[model samples]
Target: MASESPEMNRLHPFSAVTTTLNRGIVGLSVPFFLIGVLSSVTDAVDPVWSIYLAPIGLVAGVAYGLTYYYRFEYALTQDTFDLSSGVFSRRSREIPFRRIQNVDVRQGLVQQLLGVAVVTIETAGGGDTEAQLNFVSEDEANRLQREIRRLTAAANGERSATEAETASSDEDEDEEATSNETADLETAATPERHSDPGVSEDERHEQPVDHGEPTRLFELSSRELGLYSFTSFSFAAVGGVLFLLLFANDAIFGLLISMAEPLGGPANLDSASPLEYGVFGIISLVNGLALTYLFSVVYTFLGYYGFQVGRAGEDLVYERGLLQRYSGSIPLEKVQSLTVSDNPLQRQIGYAGLWIETAGYGPDSGGGSQSAIPLARKRRVYGFAERLSGLERPSFRRPTTVARRRYLGRYSIIAGVVVAGAFGLSLVTAVENWWLAAVVFLAVPPAAHLRWVNLGYYVGEDNLVIRSGFWKRRTTVVPYYRLQTVSTRRSIFQRRLGLASLVVDTASSRTFFWATPTIYDLEYEVAREINETTRQRLQSALRERARSSDSEDGDAGVSVAFT
Candidate 1:
């Protein structure tokens, strides 16, 4: 029998109340609480009204949330997914499967407690194209994500097969047979539409997909994790340690005031020598720094206790976190950039950090999607990068002597201005000693020289490598085709110096600024050459990928798991 036509379905029934409460807490509760606090402190509103404001606001929020939930509906069609939502202003969207770039399942503390998750659908075009189904059961959300992946893969497979057949008439019969087989497979894989209106589309079909055991690449041991924490050097941990050292003693002494008066009293070191006091202060400072480092180490260990990364099919799967237990996968093809970096201490210890930046996975997504390898050796970093991008390391081109001179002049001018200003202010206000500023300004030339020497970029056959930084060095490798834009930019200063910066932008939002991959302080001609080379390389990569894809489609079997 033919399955009933797919129809729009409501989220889990409990989602209404759970969502209402969640919304109330996020949107209304805070405002109401603040208003109540303000009202009690001031005469803006009657005290009696303030007392009822929270309950009233909560009720209104629930009412609005329920109405919004009732209006929202989602349906899966053969070619596209449809979403209809909005209470006052109705909004409807039909997103083609081809446009969908990523489907993510996210669960927060509240969602975890309620056993529900939010499934976000990120498309090639962001903003309005992005669709979210919130407050679905965890099981339902996973099922929905899998279904979307399956449908999208099937669609892509068919399209690729058609393109292959069009390109080669000799494979038309084989292509036709593949199409029939794919249709049969899709039909067999997709479960019939659930008859019960109460059952969500996802909940109706939750069959698991079995792939071979994942090949483990890296796993953090307890000892390695401990070492990682020690090197993490988190500012938050240092600040926390400082806070405890400064303020915690007061509370402890306050509790035992009568017994601790003598011990808490100010020290009378007048009888002691200045050398003794100096030694004591130095020891105390060392202890404080050690305590802070220990705290940072502990935090790192907890954060990455069970970190493990592996390759499963065409995806890189990583699971970590002791308390949160986060597990995420990044499609190898979606990865836009990979960075291997190290601080001075980490470098000395022969360790580097790895970060994989992918499209549609911004830092705002709780940092779950961005692949971060906390600590690894240089070889391991390159190995992971090679597996993910299928590109080897490229030799970098260092900055020219003229560029170094330009950097020196630029840094000296800026440093001189700041130092002169500080010195003048100190002399006028009778504050700090002026000689300090002069001493700092003297180091500007070497600082600039080091920066220029450290800065370098390489445009390779299939990848671009950018090396930068002094204190914490980083080498970012970006695939040619991943680049979205390549341009030569010049500031007024750069123009005067006959120098320009080459900015390579990609779809990965994880980069510091609009996904920028920059090579700075190059001669104008060199910058333009680099930009042109990047453009040509990108075009070549695209054509190569197209040809490779066509050839893959003509092959007997192609795993569309990541497509």
Candidate 2:
């Protein structure tokens, strides 16, 4: 029996009343409660004001939400996926099945409680707002994944060995078999097999492919997301202990309060003594430690409300959301590398964050997909990356941190300019005599260098990782295949020094390496090599995909799975 096209699949039943009410309740009810409480406690305004204003707000919210909701629509065809959405305006996005890079299903706290998840579909378009979905059932999410995978496979298998095999097998069984058929099948055998990697003798003998999560797959629960966020010593995964400490101090006790309540006196007071302050300091230290732990627990519950990740068909699905949903999916082929990392404190906690890099997406949308696998089983990282690699040969070889040390020089230079510019401006604006200029010149260089040193990026043959920041450092990874375009850049100064930068642009993003990290002065040698390697890698992938198609004889096996 022929499978139904995706458009014929069930549409999510719409309930205008329920959806409108949900918007009203969420937007208006909260405000009403707050204002009601305020009215009761203080006579800031008339009690009747909130009663009338609250309903008006509720009505407005419902109207706006429903207007937007009604405009949104998504449906799938046999070969292309269509998403049309807008409130006052309309946008119809059509993406071919083969262009889909990944599918992500996510649920936030509210959606989880309501038993709905958001499905984000990513394509090769390279546009912002890459993810799109409001709420879909768990079953629907899986079905979509299987269906899309089937479509891609079909696109890949157009002229596959299966066609020749089936055609030849049919011919052999028929008494009317044409003599020309046997010769054609034999001619096609080699190219057909080459076109599809799974089209060999082993495939002929193997069982049919199954689009189900492996029975042995591991998963995380909502509680685990919260627990891992709290207990996992992946301190660096969240924030630095040093800065967290300072933040904790300022939050709990105001700067003004702390200064005013100092044991002896404020810094301006001559009578203030270190001995007197020491007594209060010990007590404050204990209070700060306890409060910091509490603060983290609160943050965890609020941020990672319904985080979950596990196997989905032939790949991995990671879902997370708080108030709004965010999800990411990594096809086996799209993944470039996998890594596990821990800071010194995190190592002690016996828990580490799972690190993932794909062809181009990253933590900030420029690199490979990133997941802070909170509370990852320490031993599983190796086996997981290896398993995925087995399914899809990585575009590059081993992961390399060669880019790590190289980043510091460029970082230092950028920081030097920014800091020096600020201080230099201060010098020009300062009053005559300009005693502040001396201080400005003295302070800027070291401060900028320290700022640069705070961030680092690592590169591997298969994956590239870049991390930057002082107070809030972020790390991103990009894979080679996901790269849509590659270019080398050189500023006049950098060109003079012979240093060049590489930018790996995906459809929706640009992953930039400004100035070769290793060589302080620009080196054209490194820049040309990176640009050349990127071009070669991209060409090879396209050729392989194209050749595979020709071999398959043009019939793509769209895996329309039975839910």
User: Over the stretch 139-233, how does candidate 1's per-residue lDDT look in tens digits?
Assistant: 77766665555565456556766876654544445435444543333334233223224223443343322322344556776766776787777
Name the best candidate (by TM-score): 1
Q: Candidate 1: global Cα-lDDT? A: 0.65
Which residue runs of candidate 2 sit more than 4 Å off their true CA positions? Answer: 1-15, 22-75, 82-95, 126-133, 150-209, 214-314, 319-328, 334-368, 372-563
Task: Look at candidate 2 and tell me the lDDT of residue 390.
Answer: 23
lDDT, candidate 2, 1-563, per-residue tens: 01334343322443344567787877777667778888889998666776678888888879967876776666677677777776667787777775667776666666667766667777544544464666767678767777776565454334243544445433223212211222232233334334543222532332212334422233455655655666633233345445655666544545433644645434432455665455446656655565556666665555555665554443455655566565555554455444445443444544455655544334323444466465554444333433333212223221122333344455556656766666677678743543333444455455555444544443344444444443333333444445666667777756655556565554332345222122122246755776677677666645655554444432111110100
Report, for every candidate in turn, its global Cα lDDT versus the true structure.
0.65, 0.50
TM-score of each: 0.70, 0.52
